[model samples]
Target: MWNPLDSITVRTFLILIGGTMLSGALVFTLAGTERKNLESHLRTHHAAERIEQAIQLLDSAPQASRQAIAQVYANYGLRVDLAPTVGVVGQAPDSEITQELRQQLGSDRPIEIVDQENKDCPAFTGPHPEDKPHCISVFTALKDGTRIKLDVARHDHPPPPFRGNFMRDLITFMAGLAVFAWIVALMTTRPLRQLARAANALGSNLKHPPLAETPGPREVREASIAFNRMQASIQSYIQERTFMLSAIAHDLQTPLTRLRLRLEKVSDPALRTALVADLTVTQSLVREGLDYAHTITTDEPFELVDIDSLTEALCNDAIDAGSEITFDGTSNTTIWGSPLALRRCISNLMDNAVKYGQFAHVSVQKSAGKALISVIDGGEGIPAHDLEKVFQPFHRLEDSRSRESGGTGLGLTIARIIAERHQGRIILKNMGVAELGLVAVLELPLAPSN
Candidate 1:
């Protein structure tokens, strides 16, 4: 289920490498094409100069030595031959090779480039068709009124030899690019990774320190500044909300206490009992409301807490108080969390089970890098649809659950807040059709060992 490419750094590195390699290949191709074109142009002009020099040499040589001199030039990729009556007919002097020859050999002497195949070539008479070479013939006049034909074959000018292994050089280039891309990916994602860590910590601890305004690129610095500002804003909002709730609870306490005193002095005993009960419910709501707000904004520092020990102590305390509760299972697990907060969380769950189901069964074990604490109650399970809604503050079941039975209804709400602050969660589910009970599973991440 896990993938390395799911990481932002890996994806960024791959994207940089792919994009750079593609761009390099494109540039390399264009450069290679340009180099080939330049080499071809130089070769053409060089071949023309060789032909002009050969002509001058033959023109000045004695007639008897001209044939021998022509044969010597053929060994150097410029095949020269002397012919009478021009063995091959030629085309107009408009081609590139022909124009270069005119520049070197002067316009005074006639010159025509042969465009078609020439039967007079030696390879043309060979038995195999592959032996025949592409030939370019030029017909021109010598200085002494002698006619000569010059032949240049494709084989005479071979392509330049490769200087080195092309593939090896290309691989080396890509490796260098990959190293550079990886460095860039790391540099680019470093700040983002830090920001992500800070954001995650913010979820569990609103008082988490703000991100440092480290010096870097403008965009990264700006993002850091923005994230810090957002963190500060959230902390401020939570503080304001906690203050408002505390103020309201403080104001309600005095009047509620005075009302309780006044109700005790009432004449009608039945009416007074009902009125006092209503006042007690109102007082519990106000107290639990404040407790819920405190859980949200608590600046409780984390410490290593032994989960098994904590649950065992709570179970023993409940047994001492005459509650039908039992604790089982041991994970020997220690986690980084607020001890008091975790105690509050586990106590609330056990209290709910005891109060609603009349009994509580608690257990603890380790699973998949988490410490799972399960508290099951032997009571009619809640409807499937309302399982999640029970965690909402002041939310209670309609039929058998009432203010007198369920208390303030903020137990689960407070418990869930504590679980989430410890980077854990509590899941509620029925015990299934055959087993008529409610199961509460508290899953918390295990503390990393030193």
Candidate 2:
């Protein structure tokens, strides 16, 4: 059997997985980008402040203070370089102050110094070669013309390894989503699978007892209730109709019998004979109608039986009656159903073939989830349009209503009712032989328990 879970439609699975993946991607991407941006901002602002403080300390201190300031700069990840001033003797006095002062004031543009009064002034340059090339440089000038230059390099700390970490996190999230998807599939599919099995069983045989009411969400419960009610209604209706038909057939028989007795006393032989013939035909029809009605109410009591045994019995009976009959197919195959009803259905087809076609050939085959029982014959085939009509009660072929043919026109109808009771069907059609013949095909669902 094809399981409902195994055959879950593609649309359902796509909806589940697609929704989860899209939501996860959106949240992960936005949060990861924000975290990276904030870290970048903090590193840049802190680096700028540390570099400025180191430059101020270097300009104000003595040689000892310079060493202390350098230590502080190392701690804060800053680099500083200083150069003293030089000048010609007595022209500008050639003192440290004159040389340093000349260098500090050498630039044409006005230099902004943080502590010009207490420290030697240093002229600002672009930036130190070792620092970031585009950094802003700060210079301080001192009293003795010693210049202190501080290079505040732009902060360019490589971003934390976001790509690699994000990929790992994404993989983990996807893995969790996959597990969650399967879990949801199991929960949702399990109930539907059960319902499918129940439907298949019911289709195969309505007499197999209606499915029990399933407990679950509202939709499933409602469906179960409706199916059960429908099954009960159908069963009750068939039983009621069958009972009414039986009563009618029984009540009509007495009046028909009395009329036949009264016609026997008629003095005119031809009139008496014609009246009796009409009564006989009417009585046969009543009996056949009751038989068809009974078939509708009959429920097959299923039991495992060898299919070959049933076919052999039908064939043997036909042969003993001097009809050419044959059975073909596997002998070991077994199926579940009412043996008497199934045998009768097969026998009825064989009888029709032999009556109209002079011989009967029976065969059985199994495929997929069904069993086929076929009866073939060699005779004039029924017309295409009349094929379905023949299964209706009292219907007869236009040319075959002679007394010798001897049928109440209910044979096919009864057989059909029996097949339907077993959750099977009967079909009649031409076998396409040039010597034209009828082929009756009976299809029955394979019993699951068997």
Candidate 3:
């Protein structure tokens, strides 16, 4: 199973990746649009300049000077075609430019004619026939009365390879951005991983201090502050609970002793017997309470012990007591813990099984750095709802009211506390012929020998 801390770190990394991709995409889109606009403006300006230069050459040339004019147009990487006009009976002008020029010439007085003839000028068009370019066409009557048309077409140049180079550069930039994002995430997440490991250790051992709150970005600093507060709160709560249990146990012992003494003085045999039994029950409860309180207060040094041997001894004692108890499974593994405390926890579980279920069957198993000990029995199982409640101190089942049947009800609670003190856990499950018996499972970490 992945640790909860590792899960948090993975989630944080994914968020960083997602945010970086979104921002990079937006920047790439804006840059591409701006480059296209600038390229289009440059093409338009080049076309306008070509038309102005062609008009100046036409004004200084003769009307029939096709070769000279075509040469000038070709020098500028343009194409030109011209045909002379023949008048009526070779006297009326046949060319489009000559007819338009005659119409302008007949206007009142010799009018200053602005060339206005519209013709398909081939000079401005490119070598590709399909790429029909726009050009300036001018018609004018020269001093000899011969009409001339100047056609100038400019070929549009494709934008240079820089646009493709720019695209490549942008791609490279985005790749670098992605790499930087990963590096940043790795650096930031390192501290978070340390904090998480510390928190997990703290859960298992309250004596350990929290991770230091190092300086970083706002989010990281805030998380560190919150974690520090949580650590202190957990320690405070555990200390308070320990103190409260101790005080309660200490204050109640005197009254319980006095009551037991008074029960011995009753006169009627039957009534006295009943009183004695009640007093005994009260004394047992008080003693169990004191034991639980002590369990929390005593910080006994731990030592390595063979868990199999420990469990076998516990089971053998129950069998000798006339209880139908047996130990099952191999018992050669070793674990580190306070032997006295571990024995108490296992014995409590076995006692509960015998008291409530009539027999106890114990088993021990080792897996994944933990030792699992289970006590199984065949009797009335606990209700699903009340299974958890039975672990609370002083809780008891309504059906098991007899002194011989129901114990002080602190056995399971104490066992759980002991297991937790060793960074372990206890679980209760229903198991029997008809699921009518109880199975108490204790999971304790495997401690290494010192």
Q: What is the C-alpha lDDT of each candidate?
A: 0.83, 0.68, 0.70
Among these predictions, the greatest TM-score belongs to: 1
How does candidate 3 fare on TM-score? 0.72
Compose the digit string of candidate 1's lDDT tens values, residues 257-357: 99999999999999999999899889988988888888887768888989999999999999999999988999988999999999999999998898888
Pairs in clash, predicted candidate 1:
none
Stretch of 10 with least lDDT, candidate 1: 122-131
Per-prediction TM-score: 0.87, 0.67, 0.72
Clashing pairs in 3: 79-123, 87-90, 87-91, 87-92, 88-91, 88-92, 124-153, 124-154
Q: Which stretches of candidate 1 lie over 4 Å from their true place?
A: 1-11, 76-79, 89-94, 115-132, 156-163, 380-385
Report the poorest 10 consecutive residues by lDDT, candidate 3.
Answer: 86-95
Q: If both were scored by TM-score, which would come out higher, candidate 1 or candidate 3?
A: 1
Highest-scoring model, lDDT: 1
List, residue by residue over 1-450, the lDDT tens digit for candidate 3: 766545544566667767777876787668667766665454434433443344435546665675687776765645444443521111222244333433544433232222222244453434443254444344444445545444445334444535658788878877787677667767867877878788777765676777677787888888878888988898789778978877887888888788778877888889989887777777777778778877766777888878889999888887888888988886457777889999999999998988888888899988777888999987788889998999898788888635656488788888987888788999999984663499998988776641
Name the candidate, 1 or 2, with the larger TM-score value.
1
Off by over 4 Å in 2: 1-10, 45-49, 52-176, 189-211, 258-281, 322-324, 355-358, 365-371, 379-417, 420-429, 445-450
Question: In terms of lDDT, which candidate is stronger, 2 or 3?
Answer: 3
| Between candidates 1 and 2, the lDDT winner | 1
